[model samples]
Target: MAAQRTIDVRAVGHVAERIYIHDSYVVTFGPDATSTNLWTLSNDGRRLDHLKILRTLEEPGGIAPIVDTERKLVAITGRSSGPPELHISDISSGDLVRTLMLYGSLDDVRMPYSSRLGHALVSTRVVDELPRVLVVDVAGNGWIAGVAYIPPDLRTSTDDRPDPQFGAEHITDDGDIICSYVAPPLPDGVDHFTLIRWNGTPNENTLPAVRADLSISLVDGDAVSVSCCLPFCDDALLVSACEAVQDAIDTAYSRWSVLRAIGLRALDTLWTAEPVWGVIRRLHHAVDAGVVLATGTQNAREDGGKNIPVSFIAAFDDKTGALRRLERVNHIAQGVSVRLCAATSDTVIVIFANGDMSMASLDDFLAHGLARDVDTHKVATTQLWKDDGKKVVHAALASTSVIVATQTNLVVASW
Candidate 1:
C-alpha cells in the first residue's frame, strides 16, 4: 500500500528546508547545512545511505541549488550581499571543486548549467542598466562567452534611451543556449517578447552570436506567464500566455490563458491548447518519453453563484501536439487545489495542496478502453503520505522515486 522512506532531517542536524535531487543523489540544505548530508537512495526506495558530510557555504545566496547529473556536480549560489558566486562540488565525494564569483545579483533566477560544455549561464546587471547574459566556463574557471544588448555605439549615446532586457533560461543537451529578450514598450503600449538561440561557440571576441529569434507581440495588455524549453525537442519551446479581452460593452475585461508549442527554426506556432476554464499551473515532461502532462484547476460557478474549483490533468503528444488524454481528478475532497504534477516514463505523480499525494499508472490510464473485454479498466492508483499531517513544501518525481519535502521530514516514495 505504501512505498515510502522517511528521513528526519532535523534529527540528522538539518531542517531540510531545501532539497534538490538528480540521478542517484539527493541534496538537502538549510542555512547551516552541509553537502555531506547528501544521500544515495536505493532504487527500490526502501533505504538511503548518507555520504560523508562535507560542509558547504552555510549562508548561500538566494539562487536555488542545482544538480547537474551529467557532470556529477552540485551548484549552490553565493550569498545575497556581494557579487553572485557559484560553488560547484563533486557529487560523489562531496568536495568543493571551485568557486566562481560572477558579476551579477543573486536575485536573478535565470541561471542554468550546461553539462555539455561545462559552462554556467547567468544574467548580470549594473546600476540603471539593462541585464546582460554571460557564460562562464566551470572547468576553466574563466569567462568564455557573453552577450550584451547595449551595443558599443549605443552605450555612449546620451539621448537614446532604449529599455530592453535579455536573460538565458536553459541550455540544451547539445551545448546550445536558449535566451529571452524583452523589447522596449511600443508607443501604443504593446510589448514584444523575443526568444533567441545561441547556436554555436562564440567568436574570437568571446561574444556569442544570436543564431535565431522568434518575437511575439503582447498586445491589449497581454502577459507571458510562463516560458521554458520543451523537453525531448531542443528546437521548440513551451509558452503560456494570459490575454485580457474587453467585453462588448467595453467596460470590463476578462482574461484567459493559452498554451502554445513553438518551433525555433521557422519561428512558427506548432500548436496551441487552451484550457476549458482555467490556467495551467504545472507542467512536467516524462523524461525520455513522448508525453508532457499539465495540471490545473478550473473555477466554475453554479446556479447558486457559488464558485467551485475542479482539478484536471491533460496529457499531450510532445511532437505532434495531439491530445492523448484529458481527465478530471477528484481524488481528495472538493475545493482542494493541485499543488504539483510530475511525470516519469510510466507514472504520473500528483501532490495536492493538503499534503496528500497520489501516483497513478500512466500505462493503465492510456490503455483504458483499448481492449474489448476490459470495458472499464481503472488505472491503479497508490496513495502516499497517508494520514501524515506534515505540510508538503516541495516534491519531485525522479526516475523511480518521489521526493517530497515536508515541514519536519523528507519522504521518498518509489514504485
Candidate 2:
C-alpha cells in the first residue's frame, strides 16, 4: 500500500456529483447544486479540465451518465419536466455530438458490452405510464433501433397504494435487454412477477411485444420477491430476492433452474442471528476477481442512542458462489450510504456517503477478513472533507487510482 495523498476539491467551486475513471482520464459530472456540467480531471488530481456543460436543460439524474471508452461516446439523461432528452457527447473532445428527444422521461441508460455495436439500452416511462425499453444507436445518428414495452396487466398501478415498480436489469453483451417487474398479489393468492428479454434486431422504430423469458417463483411464503435479475458472465443469471442471492442457469434449452442459492444474514451486534432485513444493492464482475456484491442493511436494534446502518461488500467465486472476502462498515449517521464499490486488479475500493474512502487488498482480505491491523490487509484511509453535509454520490476506479464525487467536489486518491 502506498502512502495516502489527498487532493481537496472543495476549492474547485463546482459541485462534482459523479466520477468515472476510464483508461487515462477521470470524468466528473455536475457543477454547482443547480447546474449540470461535466469535467475531466487528471488521474493525479493536480489538473482539472472542463469537458462539457449543459446550460439549457437540467440533468435531473446527474446525467445517469454512461461512457463507452472504445466508442469515445458518453450519454446522459436530461431534465424530465417536458419531453425528455438524451445527450450524446464525444469523450475525446467533449463536444455535444447529438441530443435525443423522447416522448417519455428517461429512467435509465446503458451501453452494450461490445462498443462495436454502437447502441445503448434505454428505459423510459411517460407520465402515469408503464416503462418501455429502447435500443438506441449512438453512431447511426442516434436513431431508435428497437423497442420493447412492458405488459400493461403486469405494470404497477399509478395509485397511491404501495406498488411494485419495473426496472431494467442488464443489457447482455449481444445487445439483448433484460427487464424484470415486481407485482403485488391480487385478490387471489398469486403474484405475477416476470423476467423478460428484448431481442435486438436491426429494425428501426418498431415496438415489439414484450416476451417473458423466464418465470420466477418464490420458494417460501416469507420470500417477498425477486429483483435485479442480471446476466452473469456468459451463461447464468444472477438474481437477488428479499433474503437470498441465486444463480439461475439454463439446464436444458430455454429451461432455467436455480443452480445455487445463498441466504444473506442481517447485521447483528451480538452473535445471535437476526431476521434478514438487508437488500443487495449491486453486483459486479471483475477481470480475474470473480463476482463482487454490495449489500445494505439498517440495524434494527437501538444501541447507545444510535441506530447504525451498515453496508457490506463481499467477493464470491464465480463458479461456486463461495465467499472469498467480506468487509462491512457501519454508517453512524442518517443519510450516509455506500455510494459505490469498485474492484480493480488487486484492491476493492469503497466510497461512502460521508466522503470517507477506504481500500482493502484482495489477497489480504481473502486471507484475513477486515483485519484491523494497519500492517496487514488495510491499505490507506483518507477523509476528503469534514462536513458530512455534502454527500459522496459516485465513484470509479482505474487500475492504479480511484476517484470519488461529492455534491460539491471531486476527490482523486492514488493507490
Candidate 3:
C-alpha cells in the first residue's frame, strides 16, 4: 500500500458521470454552481492542465463522459431546454468536435470503450410516448443509425423503472448490439425478460432485431420480478431476480444449464435473517475469474436508517457453479456506497462513495474462502479518507492503480 494522493479541481462540483482513464490522463465531467466543465488531469492525481468550460446552456451531470483513446475522441451527454444532446470533443485539446441533438427525453446512454466505429446506444422516453433505444454515431458525422422501440406493455408503472429498461447491455465486435428488455407486470401474467440482438443499421421503423426470452419458472404459477440482467459473455447472460414471496437474491446464468443458480444469502447466517434477505442491491460478475460479487445495505432498518452497514460478498465457484468459497468482506457505514468494484488479473478492488477503499487478493479468496476470517484483513486492507462533502461518484482500475473521481477532486491509489 502507498500513501493516498489527491488532486484538487477547486469549486468543481461532484462527479456525476464516469471517469475516463487513459495512458497518462484522467478525464472527467462535473459542474460548479453556474456551469459544467470537462476536466483532464494527470494520471498521478496531481495536476489539472486542461479544462473546457462548456456552454452556458449545457446541463451538468447529465451524461457520463466516455473517452476513446484509440481515436482521441471524448463523448458527453447533456441537454438544454429541448431534448438531450451528445457532445463529441477532442480529448487532448478539449475542443468541441460535434454535437448531436438526440430528439427524445434521454433516459440513459452506453458508449463502447473504443469509438472507432462511432456508435452508441441511447435510451429515451417522452410524455405519453413509447420508450426507445437509439443507436447513434457520435463521430463528426453525427448519424442516427437505428432505433428499437420498447414494447409499450413492458413499461413498469409501479415506480422508477429498474435500470436496463430498454438499454444496451453489450455490443459485440461485429457491430451487433446486445440489449435487455423487461416486460412490465401484466393483468394476470408474470413479467418476462427479453434479450435482443440488434444489427447496427438504419431503420425507419423498429430496428431489425432478434430477441430471446430469458425468463424461467422455478415452480408452477410463481410470479418473479427481474431486478437486473447484463450480458455475461459473448454467448451468455447474467440475471438477478426475486420471487414474489422469496426475499433472497437469486442469480443465474441465462445460457449455461451446467452453472447452478446461487443465492446471495445462501451461505451467511447474518444475511439469512428475515429482513436482510431483501438487502442485496447489486450483483456484478468478475468475468475473468468466474466469480460473482454482490453489494448492498444489510439490516438497514435495524440501524435506524442513519448509519446502516453495507455488506460485500464474493462468491467463487466452478464452471458448474458449485459453491467453492463464500467470503463476506467486512461491512462499512451506510453513508458509504460501493461506487465501484473492479478486478484485475489477481486483485479485486472495491471503492466506496465516502472515500474508503480496499483490495483483496483474488487468489486468496479462491484458495481460502472464509476459512481464516481473522486473517482476511491481511489479504484485504481498508483505508478511509477524511470526509469533505465530496463523494466518490465513479472509479476505474488501470493495471494495479485505482482512479477515483469525487465531486471536487480526483484520486489515484495503488494497491
Candidate 4:
C-alpha cells in the first residue's frame, strides 16, 4: 500500500552518501544542472554506473570522478573545450572507455585529483615563456592508465624524482621550492595558497619569493580564485584571490559586497605581473600515486575578448583538494557581486531556519572565525582545522549546496 507518492519529493535534488539518516535515492544531476559533470553518483539517481563521464560533443570533458561501489566501477573524467581531449568513462555501460590526448597553452588550467587506492591524477598546463608543469596518470583499467608523463619542468636530473613519501618539495620561508603541484592554480611567489613540502632544492621549478608584488596579468583576470590542498602529510592549504574583481562572483548579492575588509596587496600585484610561477612543477604522489585534489575558479577578467574559462577539480585526496578555510563574503544589499573563493571541510553541521543548527570548525574560516546564519543570512556553517583528529566545519543548509565531508568539512549536498 506504499505506492501513491505522486512525485514531489520536495522539488527534488537530494542524493545521499549519508547526510545523517535519510536515503530515499535522489541522485539527481541531469537537465544540465548548471553544466553537467556533477560527481559520478548513479547509485540510484538513475544511471551512469561508473566512468561514463559524459558532457559529450564528441570527446567531451570534465575528468576526475569515481564511483567504485566495491568495484561496481565508475570513473568518469572528461575534457573537451575545443580540441582538448582527455576522457575516460565506463559507468557500467555508458562507453567511451579510453582516450587521452591533451596539450595546453596560455593561462591554462586542468586540475583534478582523486585517490583512496583508485588512481587518477591529471595536472595540465605546459606552455613556456615560463609556466609549466604537466603530469598525467590514470589507472583503473579503462587502459592507458600509467605512463607517468610528468615533464614540463621540475629541472630533471632524475633520482626517480619526487619524494617526501610522494608530495616532495615545498620549502618556503625564503628558500623557495614547492614541487608537488596539482595543476591549474598558477602565479605564485607563495604567501597564502599552499599545499607544499619542498624544503630545499630548486634547479628550476620556481615561484616562492613570497609576494611583495607579482603580476601575471589576466587583466582583471576573471576575478581570480585559486585553491590548493594536500590535506595530510604535514600541511598544505593555499587559497588566493586577493580581490579586485570586475564581475561574476555568482550571486548572493555579489558574495555579500565583495566580502569586505579585503587585503591581498592588490591580488599580489596581479600575481606578479606574468611569469606564471617561473616554470610549473606539479607531480603529486610522485609516480606511485595516492593522494590528490586540485581546484580553480575564474570569471573576473573582461576586455571584450573575454576568455573566462578556468574550472578544474580532480578529486579524492583527503576527500578534495587542499583547502582549509577562508571566508570573507560581504552583503551589499544582496547584489552579492563578487568576492571569490569557497572550499569547505573540517566539519560543519548546520540545519538552521530558526529550528536552529550549528556545528563549526574549518578553523572559523581563518583569521576571523565566522558564525553567521542569523536566520539564514548565509554562511550557515564554517569551520576548518583537521590534520586528522576531528575538528571540522564548512556546513551549509536551508537551500543545500556545500560538500566536502569525511574530514574535509562542508557538507549539505544530498544531491
Ten contiguous residues with the weakest lDDT in model 4: 253-262
**What are the per-residue Cα lDDT tens digits for candidate 3 across 1-415?**
2333332322333443456565555555544324445555555444444466544335633444666767777777777787778878786676778888888677643443325566777777666555666778775475677776654444455454333356555555456665556554444544345656656543545454566554434442234443443344444544454434233223221111111232211211111111123234444566677765444433333422444343445453424444555444334422345776655555656776777666666666567542222533422335545665768767766655676777656666654
Tell how far residue 232 is off in model 3, in angstroms: 5.1
Model 4, position 344: C-alpha lDDT score = 31
The candidate, 1 or 3, that scores higher on TM-score is 1
Q: In model 1, which runs have C-alpha deviations exceeding 4 angstroms?
A: 1-14, 31-36, 52-54, 61-64, 106-110, 148-165, 172-175, 184-188, 201-221, 234-283, 287-289, 295-312, 326-338, 364-388
Give the per-residue lDDT digits (tens) of candidate 1, residues 298-401. Answer: 55433334445556667777766576887655433333555556566777667665565556567654544111113433223334545546666666666666
Q: Give one digit per residue, the lDDT tens place, for model 4 in 350-377.
A: 3321112233433342323345556755
Candidate 3 Cα lDDT to native: 0.52
Deviation in angstroms for 399 in model 1?
2.2
> In candidate 2, what are the lDDT values of residues 211-328, reduced to their tens digit?
4422233343211344334345554466554432233221111111221222111111111111223444455566476544434343433333444556666666666666666566
Clashing pairs in 1: 36-53, 36-54, 61-78
The numbered model that scores best in TM-score is 1
> Which parts of model 3 are misplaced by more than 4 Å?
1-25, 31-57, 61-63, 109-116, 151-164, 186-189, 202-209, 216-309, 313-318, 321-325, 329-340, 352-355, 369-396, 405-408
Identify the leading candidate in terms of lDDT.
1
TM-score of the candidate numbered 2?
Answer: 0.70
- The order of the candidates by lDDT, greatest first, is 1, 2, 3, 4
Q: Which ten residues in a row have the lowest lDDT in candidate 1?
A: 245-254
Q: Provide the TM-score for each candidate, comma-separated.
A: 0.73, 0.70, 0.67, 0.26
Output the TM-score of candidate 4: 0.26
Question: Comparing 3 and 4 by TM-score, which wins?
Answer: 3
